[model samples]
Target: MTGYSALNMQQKQAIAQYLQSLPSLVELDRDDGVGLKRALGNYWGQFLPEEIDSV
Candidate 1:
C-alpha cells in the first residue's frame, strides 16, 4: 500500500519522461503497454495474489 509520496523527485521525473516519450498514434499502433501496466500496479497496489501458506 505504498503511495507516490514514497518516490523521490528524480524517480518521479523519470516516470514522467517515460510517459511523455510514448509514440503518437500515427507513429505506432501500440506503445509500452507492459511497462505501463507494471507501473500502475506498483503505484496503485500490491497487485500480487496473497500468500496462502505463510508460516
Candidate 2:
C-alpha cells in the first residue's frame, strides 16, 4: 500500500466514506470503480486487497 497506510485512520475513513457515497452523487458503473481506484492510487498509492477490504 502507498500513502494510504501512512494516513491516520480518520483520513482513511474519510476516503472510504467518500468512495462509498459516490453512488449517491452519480451513477457508478464498473469503470467508475476502476477509475476511482486508479485515482486513489495516483493520489495516494497502491492498496493491498486486505487494506481495501477494511475501507
Candidate 3:
C-alpha cells in the first residue's frame, strides 16, 4: 500500500481535505456485514468455490 509520505504535495493536500470531510461521513451507519473472505471473494471474483469456503 502507498504510504502518505510517498504522495506529492497535491496528493497530500487532497488527502488532508478528505480527512477533514470524514467526520460527517463517519456519522453515517457503516455496517455492511462483510468480512475479509467474502470481501476478497467479491473483489477477486475468481476464487474456486472450495477455496473461498475453505477458510
Candidate 2 lowest-lDDT run of ten: 44-53
Across 1-55, the per-residue lDDT of candidate 1 in tens digits comes to 3877788766776665555454433243334666555564565224333459978
Instruction: Identify the superior model by lDDT, candidate 1 or candidate 3.
Output: 1
Taking the candidates one at a time, how many backbone clashes does each contain? 0, 0, 0
lDDT of 3 by residue, 2-39 (tens): 66457676665555455444545755333432433344
lDDT per residue as tens, model 2, 1-55 = 6755678866766776676567679888999878877766675333322344554
Task: Give lDDT for model 2.
Answer: 0.65
Computed on alpha carbons, the lDDT of every model, listed in order, comes to 0.53, 0.65, 0.46
Worst 10 residues of 3 by lDDT: 42-51
Q: What ranges in model 3 sit over 4 Å off?
A: 28-55
| TM-score attained by model 1 | 0.39
Candidate 1: 10-residue stretch with minimal lDDT: 22-31
